[model samples]
Target: EAEAVLGRVEDVAGLFAETPERSADSPGSDWEDRLRDLAVRAVLGEPEQAAMLARASARELQATLGVDALRVMSGSISYVRRFWAHNLKGAPKASLEAWFEALTEYAVALSYSRRLCTRSVACAVQRERPGSEGRRLAADLAQRGDEESVDYGATCTDAYVAGDRVRSLVNMAGLPNWALHEGDEGAVEAPGPLHGCASICFNKGTVVLPLTDICRPRDFEERMCGRGKPCRGFAPGQLVRSLVSAACHPRALARGLEGRITAVDRTRGRVNVDFGGTNDNGTEGALRVTLLLSDVSPVEEFEAKLQSRREALGGFFVGESVRSLIFLPLQASRPLLFGAEGVVSMLDLQHRRVLVRFGGEEPLQVLLRFQDVCLMDEFEARLQERRGVLAGPLPG
Candidate 1:
């Protein structure tokens, strides 16, 4: 059994030497075909032939393609184990066991080979090869993991690994948010002039804002007590109470800001809101905010725009600060949705999706329709036209 295993190993090694030319003829072919061929030979009691095929495959991958076959093998251990499990039950016990042991050894060797390959690739890619796409590829792969985690690792912690170290350095040093200047007067102000409201341009290309009814303080209170509905002419008190109720309901708070319109921008179709004074630090300060709304469209499109901007702006590095802008669009009657401001971290443009990581941790993703962009120049133009009509020089 020992001699048989040794012979099989040697045969596999030899097969690897000749694989390059064979593989070149069928570019991007998977290894399963070669595995199956080896299996057939082995089942026919031609262990040497099976080994030879394996050897050639490994050799071709390494020599011709500059790939480390062993490293590739290591990453594939789980797959090999699965294959073994699938075929184990019906095989001759002793022979099957010996083959399994040999496969395990192969897996270990492959893993070590992969590690070396990964190191080699890292070095080669770093010499700043002309037209080297390594940096882009690395960035793409890094994004597959959690952005916050990657950000933290690359910035807060100094942990280094083969694949993550360079990316960590790039991300940490390249994307600092210099837009936010420390000791700036605006940074220390109590509730800076409410910047802007949120608005949405819908997929079908409509922009809408909640109806604004300014009333006396008493009228606002009556409306809230249900003595009056949300029609015009509620006393200011009724309006205020109703707004407070909408802004402060526990469920609304959970959905992010239930019932209040803190400020309004008719031209932008946006609202500056206070979500019942619950602050991020869990203190009782007003949650001064702006949020964008889309008319029943998925919030993803806006998210994509935000993520794309973040990447382009190099906004992901540590200490990089971003500002918030909210947009909201209203239909005749429906629940208002949330919008965003700050650093966008992920986007799926094909799907028109986006996710923003706010306050360094919380991530919000929204899907949006094409028409629901508040800042889109097309929509803004329409808004300006409407405003001009409403303000028409007081009919002199």
Candidate 2:
């Protein structure tokens, strides 16, 4: 386990201590059992428990960060395995995502010969190709001495696939970790980085939800059509109007509220909006609020025409400096670029994306959807408080 630790990464054996310790006699079904088993196995000098614990950690990481975490975790491990590896002084040791990824790296190394990491991949394949699932895996891992070709791998790999497994559905909707936890798990309450977890125009604010609570925007409109409610989900960022009465939604003043769709919880047929001015008491700034999907109608076709006219103008005028509202949103002290300043370099009216050039010691240009950034004047207003550590954008 020490051999697997990279640079500042905590030793996999040592990092396991960060997780809650499990009771010896309890053997609970929850995450505690897995932690205890890992501890006992390490003392016995068997790596199998370590592998399983790492697997669980991997899945939980996936649950928090999304499926693309696999790529980042795998690539980080691969980069170290290469011939010209760095001393990796640049790798920060404190972030939660980095720590979980380290555990995954340890798992990947230990499971290389054992192939214990196939559970997620096999499940994804089975889901994508249920008609002919496991035909390849069966042949690849076939044992010569078996009486019949056994599908042992598929049994374990596909177990999580049969239910509403959160692992399999991690970030399928492109929501950040905070949204994945639905703002419940304080551990990942803020969006840490933009690697596996990308951002919507978090400037609009968001309502995190469960995979079961939302539906795909393109799926059939359920509650809306049934009651003359604004059914039929609109694309993210499109303008919408309220069709609901104050009784159904208090802030929605009987078909008065209007805002753009920041996100759609298509699973349970709801939406998370980024509108304001609903606060009557005006004690504090309004935050993201949830409303029934059927309760809001898309903005008028006249507004759509206005959008086309704006599109005719194409949404940019050469160069403008706007703050990116991703990663840490308003600002980030630790990650270097949260709420960082950038200048618009180009526009893609065809896709409505913009190219923003972020300035740093080494300049970087990124092409992002128009909504992911906020104009400078609006930046301070929408600017969320910096999450995580408090410091300047640059490292000392």
Candidate 3:
């Protein structure tokens, strides 16, 4: 298991190191040191190193890892300065079971550390690669230096920065919110004057969901909520609460909730959405999803009415939990529903889709249609509570 983990780590790290920008720098001078520090922490759960495992490489460390009586005794030693600081006469005795337990903890920590290292390197290299087509287009507009403001269309993030060169974005969870700085005035807060509302900025895309869309609900489809009851229309930045049955895709419990609209084509009756920004799956580009405008009536503005938890929340939190299987049809005769339980790793609103990663030793990422996935039943109550908070109405 340790060997397999080491191999995977090396493979990912090698790829990251070989990138054009990274290759110019060669092996980081402190990379090995950092790895050693991580290994020591994993093994000892502290900075202090055992006598036998001092300064060990991943391979060497793996070989030395074990909590057998002999191994523990060999690794644990106290100093005796009787004759030029000779080693202790005998190793501290411990039960095999205890040793084994300690060893297991170390191994788990080591594996975790390896994963962290691989992910860190991969993220650094990813940013150097080319961005999505829409991102490139936006970057181009920003480069032209003539337009006072560039419009990336509705339901999209990755806001244009005036002079910043186009840079690649990597998928990693828990990164500090991306902030735009303006001279000495300090960090520019979200939705700053650009659009009037709260927004979140990502290294790859900036979420600019319009505040108006959030405030005023649009009646989208009558059949979605239930028969004869019109469901709300999703705006450019809003999420698809349910699937469009006409799209020929089965409803997935969690996948449908992943997408965020990036662009909407009224003439063509199509919307572009992107998924995944929450986990190791990285930020995949937006996909063009066809909206059944002919069959389904267009979203119409509705009068605001005070209600309890029935109101909709415009979007979902990235990295939300989801079931493994999804409903995707592979053939006309039979629909293929395949999926492995995973988390909503990323959410691209512009080109609607969600990225999911199955839990395992090896990292695996898959993309599913945004509309097909739905929030799990267990989460419905929580979703309603969040909606109540965002929509600002008391529940009955």
Candidate 4:
């Protein structure tokens, strides 16, 4: 047992007193049992317990960050296998979306493996140097060298795939001591590292969630309808209204900048506004700034006028006509199978879900986020080419 557990004869002394009068058999089998228990606690029990704690920590991290997923893994005394999840909160929209997709792909791969263990499967969202806002929360466990949180960011195990039996969802994978040998009773250390486990630590605010919660919904549409949020770029001569407060925009347009969008890159989330060569204060040569779907609201005058005209024309309901295309809105962190596009068979805003048909199928009740519901004719064909670039490739 000592050869299997302690690894070497010389190390056996480390488990008991060094006093010369002590006999190895003096304490009998009872004493040996106690020592064996100590070895098990130090070798296996402690690490499993740490993994349980790491799971809790991962949960806390998710709630605080609000990202789609944030997983952490820590090793046992010598074996490392653990994982947890969290959300990335208040992150840049592009990063948030990218990470969310990557995390989903990671989850899918795990499910495909058909194996379940608390291992980590990585789907990188791109490692970035935290922006000024993100740096404040950044921490590298290696730099701290603290004892209480010894396993906080240790990486002793290889990342792999595991899942819940009922859900068939894969979420985490971690490395274990390569030299571990399973015995009839439990695992026994063979010849390998004396101590150390896998460690991963992050410094970010996130909320904790179960790793399985991050998996993508089964069979989402591979092709997205040109519908959904207005991600199409504005023409150079097109006019747009600013949706942000004056403080957030360039100083020259304090009264609110309503100008032609000279340049726009929907992928980069940037826009250049030409206030027509010069302004009254001449304070604006041009305003090139970051813009998001939320930073640009519809022109109220145009929206209100359009609504009135539609209402006067009998009704203002979208998908009211036969063969109208409708879409379901993406949820926060949770992916849905049929949220992309469907043909409108019936329209009733009064009802919670709309009745829509998909590809010659019977009408199905589907919920649509008001924002996600858009007229199909309104979708730009050119924008479809850019969809893959913006949303990233489909999850595996």
Once superposed on the true structure, which residue ranges of model 1 sit more than 4 Å away at CA?
1-7, 12-77, 124-253, 257-396
The best-first sequence of candidates by lDDT reads 2, 3, 1, 4
Compared with the true structure, what per-residue lDDT tens digits does model 1 show for residues 200-313? 222222121121211113234432233212222222122121111112222222221233443333333433333344556643433333333221112234345445544653
lDDT, candidate 2, 161-256, per-residue tens? 212212111222223322231222111122213322322222323433332332223222432222223336465677776553332222323344
Tell me the spans in candidate 2 whose CA falls farther than 4 Å from its real position.
1-53, 56-233, 247-252, 278-288, 301-396
- Backbone clash count for every predicted candidate, in the order shown: 71, 8, 32, 42
C-alpha lDDT (0 to 100) for residue 305 of candidate 4: 44
- lDDT value, residue 193 of candidate 3: 50
Tens-place lDDT per residue, model 4, 238-337, is: 6676544332222333323566553444444544444442577754433433344445534555455445544543332433422222223453333333
Model 3, 215-269: lDDT tens digits are 1112122111212222245345655422322111122223233455443444235
Candidate 1: global Cα-lDDT?
A: 0.33
TM-score of each: 0.25, 0.24, 0.17, 0.20
The residue pairs in collision within model 2 are: 213-268, 214-265, 214-266, 214-267, 214-268, 215-265, 215-266, 215-267
Find the candidate with the highest lDDT and give its number.
2
Give me candidate 4's TM-score against the actual structure. 0.20
Task: Tell me how candidate 4 scores on lDDT.
Answer: 0.32
11: Cα error in model 4, Å: 21
